[model samples]
Target: MIHFEISSYNPVLLTNSPLNIGVVETTLDALGERLLVIDRRGKVITQRLVPANNKLAIIVPFEYTVNNNLMCILLDDDAEKDGELVDNVKAAVIDMKNYTPPV
Candidate 1:
C-alpha cells in the first residue's frame, strides 16, 4: 500500500470558477485501480475506479463557490472495492478554503 496526501507544493488552485485540488503519492508505488474521496461528514462524495498508474499527481476538479469550505478525505482502495465502499487506509486529507486572487 502507498501513502498519499495533498501536494504541499500546489494543494489548491482556483481558475475560471473551478477549484482544482492536487493529490500526490508519498511513496513511489502504483496507485491501485480505485480512488475514493469523501467529505468531512463521512459522506462519500465521489468514488471511481481509475487506471493503475504511478504518476505522483492527481487532480480533482470541483465547481467553485464563494463560500466553499471542504474537507476531502482520500483513500487508496487497494482492495479494489466497488462504488461507495472503502477498504483501505486513509491516504490523505485536503482542507479547502475560499479562494481570492490577488488584487
Candidate 2:
C-alpha cells in the first residue's frame, strides 16, 4: 500500500468570479520528492516538481452559472501514470464531492 500524508486546505482561485476550493496535499513516494494536489473533484490539473521546501499551492474556479465547485489534483512528471492516477483521481473526486470536513 502507498503511504501518503494527505492534507487539505482552502485556497483562493484567481478569476473574475473567483472560487474557494479545497486543496489536497500529498507526497508521492514513487515520484521522489514531489507533491500532489487533489482538488475537490479529484482531478489532476497541474503537476510540477520543485524543491521539497518549496510551497505548493493551487486555485480552483467556481462556476458562475451553476455555482458548482471544482477540484484539482497536482502531480509530478515521473508520477504521471495514466491508469492508476486516473482511477485514483476518479475515486478522489467522488470522495471530495461527498466529503465533509471536520470543524
lDDT of each: 0.39, 0.40
Local error of candidate 1 at residue 24 (angstroms): 9.0
lDDT of 2 by residue, 1-103 (tens): 9898759877876445432444433333354444443444555455556455444433333331133333333344565563224223221221234445332
Write model 1 residue lDDT over 39-88, tens digit each, in one string. Answer: 44455545545544433333333332222332333345565432333233
TM-score of each: 0.29, 0.28
Best by TM-score: 1
Model 1 CA deviation exceeding 4 Å by range? 1-28, 54-103
Task: Specify the highest-lDDT model's number.
Answer: 2
Angstrom error of the Cα, residue 12, model 1: value is 29
Residues forming the 10-long window of minimal summed lDDT in candidate 1 = 63-72
For candidate 2, what is the TM-score? Answer: 0.28
Kindly give the stretch of ten consecutive residues in candidate 2 with the minimal lDDT sum: 86-95
**Positional deviation of residue 85's Cα in model 1 after best superposition, in angstroms:** 14
